[model samples]
Target: MKVRAYGKLNLTLDVLGRRPDGYHLLDTVMQSISVWDELDIQTSRQPGVHLQCNKDRLPTDSKNTVYRAAKFFLEDCGLADQGVYIFIKKYIPSRSGMGGGSADAAAALRGLNEMFKTGLTTEQLMAIGARVGADVPFCVMGGAARCTGVGANVEPVAPLPDCWLVVCKPPAGMSTPRAYSILDQYPLSSTQATPRMLEALEAGNLKRVAKCLGNRFDETIRLAPVRALKRAMVDAGALGSMMTGSGSSVYGIFVSEDQAREALETIDSMGRTFLAQPCSGI
Candidate 1:
């Protein structure tokens, strides 16, 4: 089975507070983008998960989310005796806060279900996915969603209006844990843009959606490249721009493909860049 696992962008992210378990509460709007990673998976009689990636630097063992997800799914489904081999064609950059790893894990769960002929429902798959990673549930569903409660609780929302996005990731990547730690130092605020962003999405108002773009991490995680990239995006005619998820990768929303392509010409050489649009249907 072959599966295309798509990355996501945060339309708006707000940190609520730290939970007793140390996981930070989050209220955010997440949208799957056209950018994706491909996974080719097949079942085997051998009772172990085998994994390979085009990117040699990534781990192929239990440390990798793909391997862990395979184990989790098989165990949960009472198919622990079954095994699978996974080959990954990676596109999304690691640690860029694009949910690349989670996407891969979600794809593995989906492919394994098909390969094994398991009749699990979408909700069942998403529930199992949540055991592997916070973003896994959202990645499993794919499209526009409001994710809260450490990002495992996903509520599908109306799709955003068609628009082009220019995504850029700097050489330096930010750690999610570290970003949350930094955020914990500051006191909580009542300000939140997710509700307004959702309202704009429901109304199909692209301009309002652009104006409502916000991220709580932007206030605490100050990376010069991220700031510069946002400015460059606006200077190149982006409707609005903000860093997605934790840090490192930034995306700019453009009304048209021509404008997005023009902005890419100016920002592409600056770092690893990609031009994409809103994606749906997994």
Candidate 2:
């Protein structure tokens, strides 16, 4: 079985508060993009899960979410005797706030279910995914969504208008834990951009959507490369641009593919750049 693990962008992220358990409360809009990694799975007579990735730096053992996801799914379905080998063709950059790892884990859950003939519903898969990572549920239920409660509570929403997305990631990666730690030092605010962004999305007005593009992390993490990338996107005629999720990767919404391609050329040398579109559905 083969699955495409798509990357995601946070159209609007608001840190509501912190939970007693230490997970930050989040109300955000998440959208999958065309940029993705691929996962291939095959049944193995061996009674254990195995994983391999194109990226040598990533762990292929139990530490990997993909491996854990397979184990979780099998155990949940009472099919531990079933074994599978997972191979990942990685494209999405790690630690770019792009949900690359989460997406891969989601793919494992999906692919294993299909390969093993485990008739698990989408909700069931997402429930299993949530246990692995907060973002896994959203990746399982792809496309546009309003995610809350540590990003596992996903509510599908109206899709964004078809527009080109220019995603750029700097060489430096930002750790999510570190980003949240920095955010803790700052005072919380009642102001939120998610509500306005949701309204704009429902209205299908790209201009309003652009105006409401925001990420709370932007106010916290100050990096010269991220700032430069955002500016370059705007100068290249993007309707709007913002850093997705915590840090590092920044994306711009462009009305025209031609314009987005032109923008990609301008920033290609700055960092890894990908031209993508909003994924329409799961």
Q: What is the clash count for each candidate, in the order shown?
A: 0, 0
lDDT of 2 by residue, 154-250 (tens): 9999888889999999998889999998989987646898999999999999989999998889877877888998999999999999999997899
| lDDT agreement with native, every candidate | 0.91, 0.91
**C-alpha lDDT of residue 257 in model 2:** 86
CA lDDT for candidate 1:
0.91
Name the runs in model 1 displaced over 4 angstroms: none
RMSD per candidate (Å) reads 1.0, 0.9
The superposed Cα distance between candidate 2 and the true structure at residue 192, in angstroms, equals 0.3
- Superposition TM-score, candidate 1 onto the true structure: 0.98
lDDT of 2: 0.91
